[model samples]
Target: MAADTTPPALQDFLTWRLHRLAKLTDRQSSDAYTQVFALGVGEARCLAAIGQFAPLSVKDLAAQANLDKAQASRAAQMLVDRELVLKSASETDARGVVLTLTRSGRPLWKRVMRLIEQRNADIFGCLTKAEQRQLEAVFDRLIAHADARPQGSSPATP
Candidate 1:
């Protein structure tokens, strides 16, 4: 038989579907953050990460916030400029700095966290509790598998 010649639809790709879902959720989250806190998603993410994992270096902040180093650095600087975050030189790493929320930032941090919790609830509300649990487990496994794979590796053959 001749090889198949049909073009694949976008929906046929799992990665595309996941990207579309991420875009939808990210847009919603960005709008919510802007409306309630006048903050960008990057800033909010940085604030949440710093609040939850204080004394983090810029490198650690990038990892915790799921952001690249440049984005984390810019957000950290903005927070520092707003007096919401204090950046101090790290004692352990001479070239690195640690980030911590200021007293005023603490209240904002709480608000951000509450907003995040609400958003998560709203987004996943369509799913039953058991389905949500199953989805979470599936996501965890997928993330672990992705992490275990080497970057730029070829996809496994069927």
Candidate 2:
């Protein structure tokens, strides 16, 4: 048979498209946060997670922020160095610690949250309300499916 001339449909791949979207979204947020708060993406995520879920452990922040333990720890330390988050021993777990926004951090968190809301609206503005809802539902399903899979398992495998 003659050599196949068709190009790979990367644009049509769900994973590829989602990855592209994520990168775009992250870059936009990163730029905005850095401009306003002098924070990198990981640091901003950790800050937001801590602000939104105060009195939570670092492990919980890592899980909520979708960051690994090391990354989360680094971010937490940075936040502490900046005095934006307060770290203290966990009341429930003697060996564990919890994080919460400092007085200064609360106002910053509010501003960041407002910016995020605007950014999300701008990003999803192209879609209709129904389409947005549909997309969110689909994303929920995709997230659940991916999260339920065994780590390192090939998608093509059982």
Candidate 3:
């Protein structure tokens, strides 16, 4: 048995796993929405965020998406151009706009959500309910850890 102490191995593992999960989910959704739209994951994500929590400002959307505000603003503009989303000048603030999923967006929202639910169910079916809960608890712990860290630091690396 050779030395097995690898520094930052856990950190590297966590980063790889996180990115892998994102890629897998995006691939599935890419297949799900294959022919109906011309949106990339970023665009679809912005739409999904607005679809779930509409009437939010671009700033709020950025916070929710963990995206740059300028990027969110541009994504929202593209969505608007496609008529998949609607944005209105804010009544409360002169420098803000509020966004909502449009009528044409309703079906797309439903479709994406259905795909998400199905994939979630499929993934969860591999474990017992208790195991599922444990997995979720582990994820919650990591989330709390990330929440507590300084903006750009990772626990295992820091």
| For model 1, the run of ten residues with the poorest summed lDDT | 149-158
Better of 2 and 3 by TM-score: 2
Q: Which candidate is the best by TM-score?
A: 1
Residues 1-158, candidate 2, lDDT per residue (tens digit)?
99999988989987899899999999999999899889988988888899888887989999988899999999999998999999999989999999999999888888888888889999999999999999999989988998999988975755
Which pairs clash in the backbone of model 2?
A: none
| Weakest ten-residue segment in model 2 by summed lDDT | 149-158
Write the candidate numbers in order of decreasing lDDT.
1, 2, 3
In candidate 1, stretches whose alpha carbon ends up further than 4 angstroms from where it belongs are 156-158
Candidate 1 has an lDDT of 0.96
lDDT (0 to 1) per candidate? 0.96, 0.91, 0.82
What TM-score would each prediction reach against the true structure?
0.93, 0.88, 0.76
Each prediction's RMSD over C-alphas, in Å, is 1.6, 2.4, 3.5
Per-residue C-alpha lDDT of model 3 across residues 27-138, encoded as one tens digit per residue: 8766655545667656777887898998889999997766799889998898899898899999999989999999998788777677667777875788998999999999
